[model samples]
Target: MNMGTRTDSRFMHLADIVKVNLELEQDWTGLAVHKSSPRGDGDCDGQKLLRPLLSGLPPKRLYIHPDDQIDMIKNLTGPGESETEWVLPLHQSENPTTISMLASLFDSLPNPPVPSRRKRIILASVHNDSTVVYYIVHDGLVKPRQN
Candidate 1:
């Protein structure tokens, strides 16, 4: 199947993973999880994106870009529940390069909120083999920790 046809299903797969992962309390809680449609394309059915619901904090939005489209926003989360909503954004990966895409994806977000003066996005990259890698991507430069 072509990439376009595959995109929708991939998002569905990823969303389910995100829901289950959150339910397990891996890093986030499953406080009303659901997907949203992509903004500019009919190809993207808008079911892969997610938003906050009953999180007890505030509302948040999750943006998922197309496979070939990297110049668009990939993820977003509203304020109030910055800490709680930070654990979403799951990307289904077919390979290792998917991890690298996180950088470009995060760069395209539209007016991403800065929680406590820090800008960051959570990436849950699921490989084709069913292995998923989680990452916290910061908006700008980060200082190394001394431990």
Candidate 2:
């Protein structure tokens, strides 16, 4: 099998793991996550290949490289836009996503966040036992919730 196939399979597997967890543990009744096609150039997964969460939210780009060095720019949809363009990055569950990586992602965003709106990405890390944990990474510091 070629490298592209391997990456596709990995993404598909991750997506499946995520879906199962969402249904069984998270109580996501009608959740659906789609795996994107590979770019076919043997490049690491990024915005080019996305796995969107549900139907309303934008698809998240999958990144599995040990090093979080992304060169793609995130497309930020303007306010009032019906759909979110481009994609959000998702770190593989097993990978250690550092604060610097998160900062780079935020810096790569095409548009600045508007008041009352925050920019974030989903980091889906899968464990050795096939359990995946998803975290929402914000662009910058956010106010703690009172709950």
Candidate 3:
């Protein structure tokens, strides 16, 4: 970190989070909190792949249409056809200040927040900023979960 970084309001102050770059492709590498990644953890499982891939990109979009949802729900059950990873192309953006601010804000939370499909994807939130915050979203089910 540069000593003069304090002067820049848009710099990463608490950017302690480190990532592992798994992909050799120039467009995207991996990112994670751990120095070493777990085996068979899958591409979409950790920050190692998801973070840098989404850093400056738009809120993720679904490639399949609504009609396919019904088909998938009926036929693609019981894990015979699970996908390896759904690739979404991204454009780079920077938000050092926002990330730093978020780090401080979320530091107090005890539980590590898990990203479900609903909370993960944030479609239509893109603007002229360097990098915007993105969340996860899940596949829709006909009946809600009952415990």
Q: Which candidate's lDDT is highest?
A: 2
Clashing pairs in 2: 52-59, 93-125, 93-126
Q: CA lDDT of 109 in candidate 3? A: 19
Which residue segments of model 1 deviate by more than 4 Å? 1-5, 25-27, 30-82, 87-116, 128-131
Best by TM-score: 2
Candidate 1 lDDT trough over 10 residues, lowest sum: 50-59
lDDT of 1 by residue, 11-33 (tens): 66566666565556444444554
Model 1 RMSD in Å is: 11.6
Candidate lDDT (C-alpha), each: 0.45, 0.46, 0.28
| 26: Cα error in model 2, Å | 1.0
Question: Candidate 2 on 14-113: residue-level lDDT in tens?
Answer: 6667667655765544455534322232333344333333222332422222221221223333223333322332445445456775565444444433
| RMSD to true structure for each model, in Å | 11.6, 11.7, 15.7
* Candidates sorted on TM-score, descending: 2, 1, 3
Q: How well does model 2 score by local distance difference test?
A: 0.46
lDDT of 3 at 77: 44
Q: For model 2, state the Cα shift of residue 41 in Å.
A: 25
